[model samples]
Target: MNAEFVAVFVGSSIRFAAPLMLASTGELISERAGVLNMSVEGMMLSGAFLGAAGAWATGNAALGLAIGMLVVLPIALLQAFLSVTLRANQIVTGIGINILALGATTLAYRELFGERSSAVIPGLARWSPPGLGAIPVIGEPVFHQVWLVYLGLAILLATSLVMRRTALGVALHAVGAAPRSVDQSGLSVTRLRYGAVLFSGVMSGAAGCFISIGDIHTFTEGMTGGAGYLAIAAIIFGNWKIGRTVGACLLFGAASALQFQLPLIGVHVPTALLVMLPYLLALIAVAGLIGRQTAPLALTQPFRR
Candidate 1:
């Protein structure tokens, strides 16, 4: 391929991966804290709908993004209440929430934009680092991106540091591995788990917004598709490590970009197959094809103090 094509491909990969990166970052933290937050799909869909609607109403993408994140708090709280407080089955609750979010968002979209479905929504502005954007041929195409991509990268770095080098990180790890010990040490397991879930919700909100506003600059019913589940799959594929998970997300992003890229080079591959690539990798990862996985001991187990 030409240099320009390669540059565009790389940029597209990063753009597509941004949402996965954001969602997986939070989901990793939540899983590490022993909550298998399955409601991520629902949260993302809700955020996509809300962000689109808000931007349409207020004519401000940033404000819409804020509204989306803020609105998901109640949903996250409900997930925490059900899984952490009521000790409901995590998988079941997550699936139910996904179904509910899908229906609710679809209904809301139809009711709110039935006639104006084709209206243009404001999108987040593109940005690049001061030095990077000034580089040679490969600069603009590869570096210029929605601001959320940079924000996601920053959050990933901060999260990695916090997970590896602090008291709170230790406590979070311990809570997932040995909640009883965390309880014995006078830490509040419930609080940590709740916070983790809430963080996941907010990140999922950003991820959904990345799709609807950051990339497409429009909203479509169920536009998120299965990106949320793919984030979970990325976690599993990475063996629950932060860096590996990010790499998995990028790999998936490249696979997604290939759906469009290959066709341009006269390499006609099926779009459906490219879309399924990430999930296929996820299944392989789950089936222990890559290596043995070491999950937190108390993952998905209700902490009974």
Candidate 2:
């Protein structure tokens, strides 16, 4: 409504979008490498749990963040091994991993926290770019974000450059679209897919850590709450491109912010609709923009050689 409100809204939108942006970047790469990693949700959950636990135990959010990212590698490896080596059904494997992560995280939380659920954990520090923080009304409110947000943006830019302008990027793209050709060319499709899945796991872990530590400064059972799926939907909505996918994440974040803003502005919108808006838009975008087209030619297909 007002300038101040608008700034807050915009800032909140960015915060909400950061995780999806991070996860989507990783997913894009994994999919580009011909591995349809379905377990991003589970990976994110594991990261959140591990990151939070590490932070609480060490009293250092940075250490927690590192631990979270490190711990998710095994899960990612499992996904890659199943989808890449065994040629398991990607969707089933991903869903199964998600279920397992949810149960495990819940049980672990109960066991670790016990009655100390209300205790506080150290959160990531917040910082704003020097010049950007100086603006009058909109600057601080919008730019003073957790440092991880900045880190994520940097990673996004680096990913964009790598995806658009690098030999390895070409290899990744080739692996997804023409794995047989890649294999024939002496590249190991298996290795490429494994690397991509591992990268996705690391990014998912970072994203999850952002939620549990950077944003909430705490952990709760099932904290990811479908955000992982949202990231996948974001990839579909973005048509697998980095720039468009980032935009899609921001759009979803704005939709999420509206749930709170609408009430404040005296706009009588249904809560359910506001919450469902992002998913609905993603579905529509996918349907309208992706009809009849297909993903990478070799996506989910294991290399025979």
Candidate 3:
């Protein structure tokens, strides 16, 4: 492909990956802290619905984003309560929550915007670094993006630092590996795990908002689709490491972008196949095709103390 085509492809990849990057960052931390956090998909869907609804209602995308993130706290708390406090089956609880969120969002969308389905929702503005947007052929297409893309990168950097270079990071890692030891060290395993899951929820909320108010500027029932699951797949593909996880997200994003790009290039690959590429890679990762996975010792185990 030509330079401009390549630049557009690169830009589309980043845009598609932005939400995955946001959600996976939090999911990585949550998984590291030993909570399976299956409800990420549900949390994302809820956020997307709430964010879009709020933006449409108030004509303010920022407030909508805030509402989306804030609203997910309770859902995250519910996930934490079930997985941590009540020690419920993490996978089942997460799947159930996902189903519930799907139904609830679909119904709510119908009730709130049934008559005005075409109403334009305010979307977040695109931005580029001071000089990045001024470059020649690759400038705008490659650099201009929703502000959330930059924010997600910042959060990813901060999370990596916190995960690698701080006492809290050590505690989080320790809690997942050996909760008994964490408790012995006078730390509350329950508290750490809960906090991690809550953080994951907030990130998922932002990710959902990115889809509804940042990129699409609109919402539809179940708009999150399977992005949350894709985020989890990204974590597995990256072997639970932050840097590798980002790479995985970008890879999946490129696969998504190809669904549009290939058609333009007169490569009429099945759209379904392009859409399935990420999940297919996810399955390969889970099947141990890429490499051996080293998960946290107590990833889904409940802590009692």
Could you tell me how far off, in angstroms, the CA of residue 53 lies in candidate 3 after the best superposition? Answer: 1.2
Name the top TM-score candidate.
Answer: 3
> What are the runs in model 3 whose C-alpha is more than 4 Å off?
none
Candidate 1 per-residue C-alpha lDDT over 172-289 given as tens digits, one digit per residue, 9 for 90 to 100: 8999999999999988999999999999999999999889888888888888989999999899889899999999899989988988889988998878898888778777877888
Residues 196-304 of candidate 2: C-alpha lDDT, one tens digit per residue: 9999999999999999989998898888888998898888778788887898899999999999888888999999999999888877776765454357788777778
| Backbone clashes in model 3, listed as residue pairs | none
lDDT of each: 0.91, 0.90, 0.93
Q: Show where candidate 2 strays beyond 4 Å.
A: 289-294
In the predicted model 1, the residue pairs found to clash are: none
Candidate whose lDDT is highest? 3
Clashes of each: 0, 0, 0
Total backbone clashes of candidate 2, pairs 3 or more residues apart or in separate chains: 0
Let me know the TM-score candidate 3 reaches against the reference structure: 0.98
Please, what are the lDDT tens digits per residue for candidate 3 over residues 1-305?
78999999999999999999999999999999999888999999999989998898899999999999999999999999999999999999999999999999989988998935966799999999999999998899999999889988999999999999999999999999999999999999989999999999999999999999999998888888899999999999999999999999999999899999988879998888998988898788778899999999999999887
- lDDT score for candidate 2 against the true structure: 0.90
